[model samples]
Target: MKTLYVQVDINSYNGKLYDFKTDIADLQKGDVVVVDTINGMLIGKVVGYTDDTKATKWVIDKVDTTAHKARLERDKQLAALRKKLEARRKAVDELTAFRHLASMDSEAAALLTQYEALIQ
Candidate 1:
């Protein structure tokens, strides 16, 4: 009847400590291990432990180097895609606004003109 608190190095959780059960006698803080999660197998680091005896049912395992590497690569690709999309959206917004600037009222046109100058 042992309870463990683990900090998983996953993107979504960002190294948050989740509850788990530890069977090994020597498990301690700062130990890197793999865990079975609802999402699949994930790598985690043991940050704390307790004898509260409430079983969380999560199992620790040996590191899955393949899954770890693949997850990192996927995160990198996703980040790049998000950056590109943000840039595209900004450019589209600027272009569309600039195109209609001439048809705006005096105050709106003046504000847009000042904004365009600042952005440039």
Candidate 2:
């Protein structure tokens, strides 16, 4: 019977360190591995090796990290978009105040002064 072995030390989110032995000959140090957890399968980085901790479960797989990369990229784009939207909102409000001021509305200047103060 073949049993699972984990040899690499992993960085887990919960700050737990584990030692496992694997039959995967090419499973080297510094690889990203998928391991089974109580919550779900999580990705961990193989930072080093150790003989200290015991492993009772298997490293499910070694993933390519395409999904992770894509998620990071999407988040970056989303942040940029949100920042642009906020800037545009401010600009639109300022333009509306200018229009009111052009019509000689009395409170428009006060509104613009308040906006400038808030921004500073």
Candidate 3:
């Protein structure tokens, strides 16, 4: 199977980015990506290609079988953690709505803080 590395630059605050070899004819622009945010392994679509030096830069860290496995595992864990976080956020929203109905501003504000913490 053809694999691509999900890449990002520290300067860009965008969610995630990807880089792949252009030699693969099947890969096209605007493909959706499933990326390993840390291990540099993931699935992502081809957003576009650049002739810029960044695209051709040699990868300092070589990807190995073990690293690939670790990246997959880490992606799975992050997915689970995100689900839990969303649930907590929903709870916070519900509590805030209830507090609003009861005219409890202080409680609503506190719940908002809790919600932010859960997201972070």
Candidate 4:
């Protein structure tokens, strides 16, 4: 895998470095590349390279309007899935805390069990 340093021009942030790795050879600095991000398909300019972080990189040469739109849609779907997962995780944590509290005190245990039944 070849490492490439990219500069992304975003509205809220300026000149943030997004390091990407690619199997496609001959990528040079200042080359406009399409990168898949959690936000969307970001148009990034290759600045340089780095020896930091190792992961599978998904890098594309160019992104047209159609591809960009598809990327955005996919990202939206992923965000929704992540939100649902986080909610489930929060519920599990709350239940675990309640169970721990119930184990500590007998008086509160009855009240906590009732509350848990209502939520479920």
In model 1, the worst 10-residue window by lDDT is: 2-11
lDDT of each: 0.68, 0.69, 0.53, 0.68
Which sections of candidate 1 miss by over 4 Å? Answer: 1-12, 51-55, 62-120
Model 2's alpha-carbon lDDT is: 0.69
**Model 3 lDDT, residue 5, Cα:** 37
The TM-score-based order of candidates, best leading, equals 2, 4, 1, 3
Q: Per-residue lDDT for 1-120 in model 1, tens only? A: 544444444445865666667666566666667777788877677766755455455656644368888999999999999999999999988878775865666777777778778978
Q: For candidate 2, what is the TM-score?
A: 0.53
| Candidate 4, poorest ten consecutive residues by summed lDDT | 4-13
- The model with the greatest lDDT is 2
Enumerate residue pairs that collide in model 4.
Answer: none
Which regions of candidate 2 fall more than 4 Å away from where they truly are? 1-6, 10-17, 25-28, 35-43, 49-58, 106-120
Better model by TM-score, 2 or 4?
2
Q: What's the CA error at residue 23 for candidate 4, in Å?
A: 35
Per-residue CA lDDT of model 4 for 51-95, tens digit only, reads 655534556664335777799999999999999999999999988
Query: What would you estimate as the lDDT of candidate 4?
Result: 0.68
Worst 10 residues of 2 by lDDT: 1-10
